[model samples]
Structures are given as C-alpha cells and as structure tokens.
Target: MAVSCVRADPRLVEFNDIKIGHVYKKTVTLFQFTAASPAMVVVPGLLIPEKQEEVRDCLLIHVEDTETIKIPLLEFPKVCSLLVDSVLDFGCIAANNQVISKHHPITNKGTAPGAFQVQYSRDPLVTVSPCVESLQLAPPSG
Candidate 1:
C-alpha cells in the first residue's frame, strides 16, 4: 500500500488579488454571531463583487491634494472601541534661544527684535501602514 498525498490546486490563489493602494470607498459592516459550545464556526470569508474586505491593525490612507478623507461616527460607543496609535511629528521647542529678536527696525543697534524665529515645524502627513494586529479578548491581568 502507498500513502497518498494531494494538495489544492495553486491556481486557486488568484481568486482575488487585493493589494496596497486599492481604496475601499464603500462602508463595511462587521458583525459577530455565536453558536452554542455544541459548535463553532470560523468563516475565512467570502469573495464579492463590490469590495474586497481586509482585516487590518494599522490603517493607511491616501488622498488627493484637494480632497479630505472622512470616517463617520454616530455615538460614543463607536468611539470607545476604535483604537488609535499616535506618533508625534516635528514640533517647535522653547529650548531653542533663537527667536524674533528685534522690536524696533530703525535703531539697528542691538539685535533686531523678532528678527529670527526659533522653532521647528513641518507639514506632518501620516503614511498609513496596514496593521496586521487585531485586538483579542483575554483573561484580566492581575
């Protein structure tokens, strides 16, 4: 007797090719349904026509120079669940001594007031990276 081995056809992977830079313009609804301990079902997911669903941890967004991206929230409950990761961008610090020095322009004797401004600033645009991390429920930490 010989042991038999079979693998699913590789061509099946091409069913849907969702990639970076693909923007989902439609609203996606997520829900959970439970079955008794008598059973459990894990749905890998489905392929549909309108949009491809992706589960993400970190999110990326792209917008044209003129348009604004908006996500709507109806109430506090929604906000409580949303997780945000914040990164500090370039900002000005008072430690820098250089500042607008001169108050008067005509005297031209002492350092001119408000002549130089001491601060760091930049146009901070956040590049969204696909977040592979998802939140999980676990026992409470003591």
Candidate 2:
C-alpha cells in the first residue's frame, strides 16, 4: 500500500521565530491512499512522548507497523545581540589579603531579550557575583 500526505508536506515541519524557553507545536495531516491492505505509520524517536502523542492523534492509520518516516523539524530562535567591553583589567593588587572588585557592563543591542552567562575561571582566586549560570537582560527599548 502507498501512503501520502493529504494537506501538508510530510518531509519537513518548520517553525520560525520561536522564543527561547518556550513551547511551540504544529500538526501535519497524512492520508493513506490504499485501503485494501493495512498499513502502519510510525513516527520515530526524534520527538518526546508529549509530541509523539500529538502527532499520533493527527495521523490516519489502522494498525502499528514497522514502516517509519523520518520528518525533520526545524526551529528558528529569535536573535539577540549583545555588546561588552573587550577586556577587563585590574591594574595592580597589594598582598594585604584584600578583596578588590570591578564592575563589568553588558549591553543588549538587539530587539530580543538576551541571555548572558559568565563561566568560571580556572584560577580559584577569581570569582563571579550573582553566581547563577544564566541571566536574562531585556531589550534596550524596554
């Protein structure tokens, strides 16, 4: 038996301008051409369980079979641009066991919100404040 997509393209599913840390969904409808013989359409392991359920509910098939079709899902995230100083330098430090501090500024130049992360340095003496892994900055206009 031959199967084909009735409404949408079966080869690819594309999503555009998806925000980070957000969920988006799309459905593709498929039709089985021949009804004489039974056929099964399988969606492979690329998607999570929740997404699999969504696809299964939309598919028109009779029984579970080994025939599988791999569909590529493309997602484009919103872009965010950030500007920062090229270098941060501490001029000099005395051996008085004192904690000297400096300020570093990060500016978001893009319209979307930007997420920044400061990785830990190899030197144990060097540390970062607001020790979280990621921080989000709003757009300049906001």
Report the C-alpha lDDT of model 1 over 41-132, residue by residue, as the tens digit.
22222333333233322112222343322323111111112223344333544535453222221111221121222233342332222222
Query: How accurate locally, in lDDT, is each candidate?
Result: 0.27, 0.53
Local accuracy of candidate 2 as per-residue lDDT tens digits, 31-123: 444545333334432322322111222233332364544556665544566776888776787748888888877776554565777787788
lDDT of 1: 0.27
Query: Residue 140 CA error for candidate 2 (Å)?
Result: 5.0
TM-score to true structure, per model = 0.16, 0.38
Q: Which residue ranges in model 1 land beyond 4 Å of their true spot? A: 16-46, 50-52, 55-142
RMSD of every prediction: 23.3, 9.7
Q: What TM-score, to 2 decimals, does candidate 2 have? A: 0.38
Best by TM-score: 2
